[model samples]
Target chain A: MEDRFEVSILLDFYGTLLTDKQIDIMNMYFNEDLSLGEIAEINETSRQAIHDSIKRCYKQLKNHEDKLKLKEKYLNKKTEKENLMKELSKVESIDNDLLEYIDKKLELIINI
Target chain B: MEDRFEVSILLDFYGTLLTDKQIDIMNMYFNEDLSLGEIAEINETSRQAIHDSIKRCYKQLKNHEDKLKLKEKYLNKKTEKENLMKELSKVESIDNDLLEYIDKKLELIINI
Candidate 1:
């Protein structure tokens, strides 16, 4: 489950960098939790081909992540935004209404 | 000048997807305003080779921008954030201090 989740996150960041076939296979394998044999059936390829394609997809995705670190930077920014929200919540002297407004805006920015 | 600026902005969003040689050549040609002959001299390549590389780099960058629209989306977001800041500025009856604080925060978010 953990491995699948990590791959999904990587796909989110670097999926566009992949070929359409690699992306489709990855979506089935990681997102849909499809087995290699099932993917082979759907892709109309042999199990060995499906296996190799998935392996290559993983390698390419990991290589992109390693070179760009887009996923890592994204996660770091998420953490930073969360921390900022916490600190904003802790501010005691600001008007409560303004703080609430700011909190709402912060959530929007982080989601972006 | 306008074309060069547009290319530089495109490079900013999609440059990591490019080879290091492409990036270096682009930086020399665009950012440093180097002529093809100057770049060729520095790279120890023929001027025609430098020219061809730059042309290919432009095509590749344009292709990436066309597929992803990252630069267009980035420009749109910048405009949206600026519009948002304007709207935030026009709100009446809020504490001017709180408004100033919010403006600063908004700037930070857009710059991110």
Candidate 2:
């Protein structure tokens, strides 16, 4: 479950690097959790073809992740932020203003 | 000056997406601050060819930046961290541990 979510996150980051068709297929397969047969039927193609496309798109996305490691960086940043927030929780009552600022900044990071 | 630095930052993020030759040429030209003639001499190619390669690599890097925006994400993260640090400075005496943790995390992000 988490692995598929990771793939979807990669698709969000690097989807534009792929072709429009590839992006659509990935969204259907990964995000929509559609079977290859369903995607093939919708695109009027063979299931084999959809399978091949998904495989290729997955390879491409993985290559991007390997080369750039943007996903890894993102995960690291998220962890760091979480740790910082946790540490801040230890000092909550004493520094309410700083606590509020960090909270808002975390939200900003999520949206960005 | 900042523009070239920005390009170098983009290269750091997307340089691996390029071919080995393209990455080498970009590093020489952008990071080493080499002229086309200098890179041409090192690569044993004509200056015009080197220029063309640099232009193409630049376009490729820009396209990657446009698509993934890892640089923009990094900058935004930096700004957010800086702002948080600034806010923390106001409450330095109150929460030393959180301030120290954030300082370490910012350095970690930069290295990552």
Candidate 3:
């Protein structure tokens, strides 16, 4: 399940970078939770065709993830930033200067 | 971008649910860095058809993500598990009984 999320990240990236039909199919299955039969009906294609496309897409997305490793790095940075934000939020009191500094840092992190 | 990773996760999930053609286009674009013209040439389709399919796919994927929120929860749990693992790994030494317990817990997390 955890790995699935990682895979999801890869897929989303792939969708954006790839062709429209790929994105459409991805959205239909993942977003709509449609069965292969249902998707085929909608797309006017066969279930086997849909299944093959999905499997191939998964492989390609995973391959990209393995090569780039961008998703892992991004997740790590996001986790760190979230933790820092939590810490900052828990602080009961802060000097005005420190508060300003933290706010600035947070803004930058959030923007990223 | 940070948001892009989250989107990627959604796309990957969508791809799994979609048709074979969808997956093929996704792999061609995201994994192979193929342009729309190239993709159309390979698929023996019109560029406009590819464009429409991709745009529609993005919209549908985002819609699913917005409604389901599964990706967000998964990411949070994963981040927490990773932190716990890090803490456990940092311990200098452990008593036999405690080590057994920690190891058990770590094993469960890794399996998840």
Candidate 4:
């Protein structure tokens, strides 16, 4: 049950939960497109520190994902919700019963 | 310019470029939170195939990011656009000059 989550969940969670500096570096390097040297310069840290912070953040993110599986669950629910939305969107006309069914499905998606 | 792009750009592009089967496996395992075993059973492929596909996808994504730098540029531009929008939204009153400035900024954002 727990072993089924994606590797990126760890990465995302780690990115979210780490120190602001670490998150900044990760976002800059991974999300923002900054080089290690540039990040080091901006943050006034060494390139090695930036590199080590990234590696550590990666490990932590992976470990958390492996243990918690929250990101995986969230992603699965998101994908399911998206698919349901696509299906609903494709229906040009909806009977009352179908609309009610879709409303219930949407409720489930929103709650998740 | 090239070295500054985030790592995930590569991943996203690779995910887009791969075979449907490979993409499906990736979305299920990484994006959809399916287990390797579960994905294997659904796809009727071996666990090793799933593992290898993920690894290969990761490599390709990284290579593309390193080579093209498209993702990084896109992200930086996106972040800047978001910030500009945020700034524009915070203004309670807009004079003609300010409105014109914002319109130009919006046009740039839209074109990007």
Candidate 5:
């Protein structure tokens, strides 16, 4: 099975669009790593109800991702940042201040 | 007036999402730097019609950009790339091969 970690990543991109209750449940399930029963206990709902809500919310996040692809572009930029950083680390003679400047700029590119 | 060049930049980021006809007219107006009458002559439509269409399509492009901010992010990354390139150019001690690789990878980050 795929890792639940992806849900949290998707949440980072799209969590604001989701309802407050949905975001709460998702945080508990994905961020807190709580099972449905644990979430249900805190929310005063049945485990089955929490399960259904989580399923629906996951679908919503996936739909948003499929349409906008913000996460995909972010991952691509991040990979580029990593590759450039590796190259920067290998060069022995570059100045410390220059290295720091390049590093910060590279991160700024990926920060979007 | 704001630069018409911006529409072309926005088109580069969000053009495919626009309809074929809208994109065609946008290209004629922004890319070709054509006036409304010039666009209408080629499309066999009135200048007013072409004007309205351009207005609508510009609005559509703005809407997509508003929701996604892909253009904003793209510009940010591009600026970051530019700054890094400038810094690289000033550093005379860096090896040519390493410099080229860094430039290419920095471009890759903004490619998205």
Candidate 6:
């Protein structure tokens, strides 16, 4: 379960850097939860080739994250923004429209 | 002037990945406005070496930015946050405390 979530986050961060074939295999295995043989059948490749491509894709994603740490920075910013939103909500006499506007800004930060 | 600002932005984005000597040369050349000969004298290297290192550093920074684009993404988010802040301030009956809190959150996003 933890590994699944990690792959999802990795895909979010570095998926664009991967080759199209790698992405297709990853989407099949992780997103679709297909077996290695299933992906091989879909792509008309050997199961070993499908497995190897997925492994290579994972390593590339990890390497990119290791070099950049963009995902770590993004997660930190997201946590900080959420905490700020909580504090802003607690401020006395804050208006609903103002709160909504602030919420929108925070959503932008987290989504980025 | 435009080139100076570009270097500053580039430095901000990829300064971490540069070698210590490269960073020193960049700081002296761009931030301190030191000439190549002056930087060479300070670093005890040839003026040509200083020039070469600065050029290499700039290329490395540009390549990093091309691959990741974190700086570009940051600037876009900052612009969006500023616009949201402007809209937030225009909302009716927003208290000073709420406005200040929202401003703080926006600052956090921009600074990130």
Highest DockQ against the true fold, candidate: 2
Report how far off residue B99 is in candidate 3 (Å): 40
Instruction: For candidate 4, write residues A1-112 as lDDT tens digits.
Output: 1121333345454444567777777677776677889999998989999888877877776665564444654566456555544554555543455545544544342232
Q: For all candidates, what are the clash counts?
A: 0, 0, 15, 4, 0, 0
lDDT per residue (tens digit) for residues B14-83 in model 1: 7887999899999999999999899999999899999889888899888877755656756665666566
lDDT of each: 0.75, 0.80, 0.59, 0.58, 0.81, 0.79
Candidates by TM-score, descending order: 2, 6, 1, 5, 3, 4
Instruction: Please give the distance, in angstroms, between residue A96's alpha carbon in candidate 2 and its true position after superposition.
Output: 7.1
Candidate 5 lDDT, B1-112, residue by residue in tens: 2258889788887786777889899998888888889999999989999988988888887877776677787887788778778778778888788788888877766776
List runs of model 4 lying over 4 Å from the truth. A1-112, B1-14, B86-112
- Among all windows of 10 consecutive residues in model 3 chain B, the one with the lowest summed lDDT is B103-112
Tens digits of per-residue lDDT, candidate 6, A46-102, equal 999988888888888887778667678778788887787788677666656667767
- Residue A75, model 6: lDDT of 81
Residue A97 lDDT in candidate 3: 52
Q: What is the lDDT of residue B90 in candidate 3?
A: 49
**What TM-score goes with each of the models?**
0.79, 0.83, 0.41, 0.37, 0.66, 0.80
TM-score, predicted candidate 2 vs. hidden true structure:
0.83
Compose the digit string of candidate 5's lDDT tens values, residues A1-112. 1258888888887786788999999998888888888999999989999989988999988887786676898888788777767767767887777778787877777877
Ranked candidates, highest lDDT first: 5, 2, 6, 1, 3, 4
Report the lDDT of model 6 for residue A100.
76
Off by over 4 Å in 3: A1-7, A90-92, A95-112, B1-112
Candidate 2 per-residue lDDT, tens place, A49-108, comes to: 998988888889898889888778778867877776777777645567667776777767
Candidate 6 runs further than 4 Å off: A40-52, B42-44
Q: Write the per-residue lDDT of candidate 3 for residues A66-92, one digit (tens) a residue.
A: 644446645665565555445545445
> Model 1 - which docking category?
acceptable
lDDT of 4 at A86: 58
**List of chain A TM-scores, every candidate:** 0.84, 0.86, 0.71, 0.63, 0.83, 0.87
Worst 10 residues of 5 chain A by lDDT: A1-10
lDDT of 4 at B12: 59
